[model samples]
Target: MQNRGWLVFTLGVVGTLLALIGIFTVMEGQGLIQPRTIGLIFFFGTVALYAVVGLMVSARKVSDYYVAGRDIPAFYNGMAGAANWMSAASVIGMAGTIYLLGYDGLAYIMGWTGGYVLLALLIAPYVRKMRAYTVPDFMATRYEGNVARSVSVFAALAMNIVYLIPQFMGVGMIASRFLGLPFAWGVFVALAVILLTTFSGGMRGVTWVSVAQYLILLVAYLVPLVILSVRLTGNPIPWLAYGKALEQIDAYEVVHGMTRYVQPFTNMSRLNTLGLIFCLMVGTVGLPHVLTRFYTVKSVRDSRISVGWCLLFIILVYISAPAKAALVRNDIYQNLVGTPINQLPAWMDTWGKQGLVKVNDINGDGVLQFNELTLHADMIVVGAPEIAGMPYTVSSLIGAGGMAAAVSTSLGLLMVLAAGVAHDIYKKMINPNASEGVVLFWSRAVLVIVAVLCALAALTRPALIVQMVAWAFSIAAASFFPAVFLGIWWRRANAQGAVAGMITGLVVTIGYIILSHFYKIQFFGILTINAGLFGVPANFLVTYIVSMLTAEPSKEVQELVTELRFPRATRLIGEEG
Candidate 1:
């Protein structure tokens, strides 16, 4: 009866939202609402909804705050997980990347999708079995020492903060473009909502809210693509119908004297592409924010099941990316290219004012050439409806969807950062006797501080959204992947070995990224994005060598590894230990 009621409520909310969107679209067509007003309503209306849900489900108990009382059903958990996983990079930057990079951008699709498979097969269920509150908690218990816990904490903070900055950048982009705020100020606007959603409900609030966000973002993403597809090829399904559009894009490139859109290895070296895919695959298993989602489910089996649902939801966005990219590119080629600068579409002026689209007319032709215009990767998805001459309401909805993607992921990353500091570091190491109230208080405190710091960093416009996210994946791959993987599979993996592995991997990967990205140091011709290629192997070697040289783990620790490998019952790993 309870489940049926919840189902009806969900359907009602979704139907109401769809009706509102339809009415708004009609209103915009009829000139009853201004474009700016529609954008504001769409963006803030969803944000207001998120705020309300956060307040309604705010966490009170420690368990609720950390793991959502371990009560999320598999289906909803999967929906929430999909929302949490599809950050701004996936939601906003991906289609833009495909538009810009052409064939090379498929690397992201392959890497991220394949990475989730690795997580599902090799990591999620085992992590759930451990039943630890945070990844560091699992490390400390598994390795029997604070050194391992502290190192894991550092890795989580480093990866998540790096990941978190791009999410804020996404928010800033959406707010600046849609809400008419300065980019820096826009970042803080999102910070307010993120803090409200996360500071109160913690994981519990984030989970339910993420389900709502997933629906909005998914709809916002697909609707524009489907409309564009039908307009271009008379097919409502973009994924299956975009092939002809791709051919048209290729022909346009040829006529414009540009590299073909389908040409592989034109933008990235083959080695770098493969290396990036490998790092992303391993990194998916290492990300603390993603692994924490599995901990919120009811059982290990549910955790595994949720991964399947997550992939289903995520792949819907992924498969549509190429279609969106191709159709948008075709639109630009057909409508904007060769037009006089002053005669270009209205979207050029709108996005140009925000510095997202630039036109130079380098050949003194007064007409825009493909080479003379530059489109920022972040703008492609959000600005697609405008580029295709769709209704203003469609573009407004895309802006709102982008906000949802950014907010949902931001909430998860914020929780991971807070738990790493407040739970793993403060309560466990500094003040083990602290009461739950004191701990929750500190968690909220850390959430604000970390969010403010990341927001400030986002104002600098560090890198493209996808590039920063890829860096996070690389860091996670290098530092956490080996430590966690070996700790679970190898009984001889002691605290000393785990600590050494994490430190070595983290130092090598970060050092390479800094040197290669800032100083132009060439490392076997590998791009900085693939720096994890060097770190993952180094960590594995160091860990293996160090573990072999050190005395083996005690019998109890060895037994725990055996139990993790072959669970005799549905008990927590801590209980068995």
Candidate 2:
């Protein structure tokens, strides 16, 4: 009865908010509200809702802060996981990547989706059985010392800090473009809201808030997609109807002497494409923020069940992405490609003012050409509604969705970073006798400090959002994936091997990223984004050899691996505190 009542209340809140957004959208269309006014309303209104939920369910206990009391239902956990997985890169940059890279962008969809399969089948349930609060906590226990845990803490901080920058960048992009705020101010504004939402409830608050974010982002993404689909192909189903748009796009490409839209290996070599896919796939399983979702569920079974739910929720967005790319491309090719520079669509100028869309006439013909236009990949999805000439309300809704995606993922990443520092570093290593209150206070402090640092880094706009996210994935894949996989499966694995493997992976992957990206060094034709292809193999080989050389783990540790493999209603390893 209690669960049902909570469900009813959640539905009521979501329904009421959706209805309000719909009314405002119509009002904006009818000129009853200014676009800026509605944009502000959508942005702050959603943030305020998340803040209220956080405060209402604020975490008071250590367990609640770390793992949400381990009582979250599978379905909601799945929803939260999906929202957490759909970072700003997935929400704002994915469709834009599809737009810019054409068929090459499908590598991301395939890699990310395939990674979940690995998580569900091989990782999530076992990790849940371990009952560890953070991945570093699991490492410390599994490897039987602080050494492995401390190394994992370093890797977690590095990867998550890199990941956080892009999320802040997405928030800044939305605020600057939609709310008319300066980019730097926009990042800090969103940071303040994020800190407020996360500072109180920790994972407990973030879990429920993520569920809400998933709903908003999903609706915001699909509404404009369906509308554009109907406009272009007279079909409401974008996934099926987008083939018509693709046909038109292909013909336009042929006529304009551009690369075929459906063709692969145009921009990147085949080997680089395959390597990128591999990195993304393995990296998905290695991500601490994503894997932490499993820890919040009721049991190992719920953890497995939630993976299924997460994949289902994620597929809805992934499949629609190609259709959005096709439809938007078709619209641009048909309507905007050959227009006079002075007569270009108003949306072009709007996005141009933000430095997202650029047009240059190399021939000085005073007309736009396909070759002269450069649209930043991040702008494609956010600007799609305006590009389609949809109502300002639709564009505003996308901004809200973009913010939701950025904020939801940021919260999860922040939790991982804070927990890594507070639980793994401070309490476990620095001050083992510290009280619960002290640990929690430091956790909240770390959240603020880390967020501010990332926001400042985001102001530099270091790289494209998706590129930075891929770099994070590469780091995680190299450092965490092998250690966790070996720790769970191999009885011979010890603290020495795990630490050695993690260090090697981090060194190799980070080195490759720096050399290949900055110094333009080439290695087997693999792109910098897929540096994990080199690192994963190196880690696995080093770990296997090192474990064989080192003393085997204790008999007790072997028994723990057996327990993780065959789950039952047994007491978890770390539950006793």
Candidate 3:
């Protein structure tokens, strides 16, 4: 702990750099200068921010840098985690998804909100009490062996790489849209900027940076939606006003109103819609960066506070997303959806030029239908900024906000990336006695390597918004979440069982994802997100089956469990073993 000398200076510099980036991004978007100037601003802003933040916050002690001193207030940790988890998908994509899919998009809304609750109630406290700087640390002790830790490390690492793909792609897309640059350049620029900031801040800088970014994401999504909602319906409560089916209203009167358009929601059923929502809600608790935040808090109770805050921030965006989606869907249909194809709004015509807005004019009435917005389902939010008719400044602000969301989530993943390399693989097995300096160096190196690789993946447009991260969430749920929950709650859950469960889940998920990516399979009529619909069940079955066959853990493992249960009696001590 004494080795962490750079902590304070890093925070000051990173904070300053973020503010500058925000200012420059806004100014550049306002047309205050050239496109290249905006690029320069983002580049300088990220570099200076990371350099100062990194050099100041983390010294040679990996634990301090990785876990934020393990004395952070639950509220602060929760706030940071919220920013980290929201990402580009939440801030910029979810509402758009709903707009494209009608009420069916409620799946993301409920799932994200429900996830934090699950984390607070089911996973947070015991893991925080285990006192490991990372999730794999808990697995090692619960299993009473290195095998569980190894398995967990690999799982956590793989899931994170999967997680990072969409965010980089988002930032790139956003930059390309706002900065008037190529998508590849935007991706490279964001990657370089994040690599600099994350390599230095480690986890410590990330916590503060994330908190600031959370504030940005919430404001970005809510402010524009609020304005759009209030402008359309004299009411600020858009959710209630907009959430109705087109048939539920007086279609004739609404058609004549000339103010608000109607969305046809009669086709969306509750049962199927709710099922997907349930999967997301429960699956959310199992996400890696999400659960890792519990380790940053000072105590078990603090962990609960963090979950609450996370839920609260998410709600701010969650409520607004639906509101925005409904309003946009109606607004588009009322004004432009039915208009002559060439008579579409300037925004659509311009965006269509960029391949972002593709109107099908299905009836050849030159009218755009709700189904037309589903061209890819990912462009809803990005297209929303312009549809609201906000000035370029506000649109740029939203773009900046989206970038902040992407960056915040990216940093959190990068920290986990650093930890997987430094703590799990390196300290646990590679060279148990590697000096603090060497560990710290490797941490920075890991950040650089992972950021670049993720940047490469982003360039390829590898996966769409929800699908890319959704697969990662499913993995977390089936594998890590089950093991962590059962490890703490079930006394008979030995290292062997946990290992077997993780291996089963990991292998199944990889195979499923690969098959979906390289091969294809259809189940009944509806093809699955991947082959993994089968894997989740297989995971739970194998976990208990293996635990039954294996001998109970030695008394030492039981003793460790007891200690974990009594979080305060023995502070979650790390194994210096």
TM-score of each: 0.95, 0.96, 0.86
1 against 2, candidate with superior lDDT: 2
| Candidate 2 structure quality by residue, lDDT tens digits, 1-577 | 6467558756865687679768987787788988788788888888888999888888888999989999887877888889999988898889988888889888998998999999998899999999899999899889998999999999999999989999999888788776677888888887887888898788888988888898889988998999898887899999999888899999888987989979998878899878889999999999999999999988888888999999999998999888898898888888887899989888888789878898999999998888889998888887888887788778888888889989999999999999999989999999999999999999988999999999999999988788899999999999999999888878788888889999999999999989998999978888889989989999999999988998989887877887898778444566544
Question: Comparing 2 and 3 by lDDT, which wins?
Answer: 2
Compared with the true structure, all predictions reach lDDT values of 0.87, 0.88, 0.70
Give the alpha carbon lDDT tens digit for every residue of 231-342 in model 3: 7666676666665524432363365563223333333445435545555665677676777787887778787787888788678777877777767666755665556666
**Model 3 off-target regions past 4 Å?**
1-60, 237-275, 365-376, 524-527, 530-532, 570-577
The candidate that wins on lDDT is 2
Clashing pairs in 2: none
- Model 1 lDDT tens row, 261-348: 8999888888987887898889888889889999998888888898999889899999999889988888788878889987988888
lDDT order of candidates, best first?
2, 1, 3
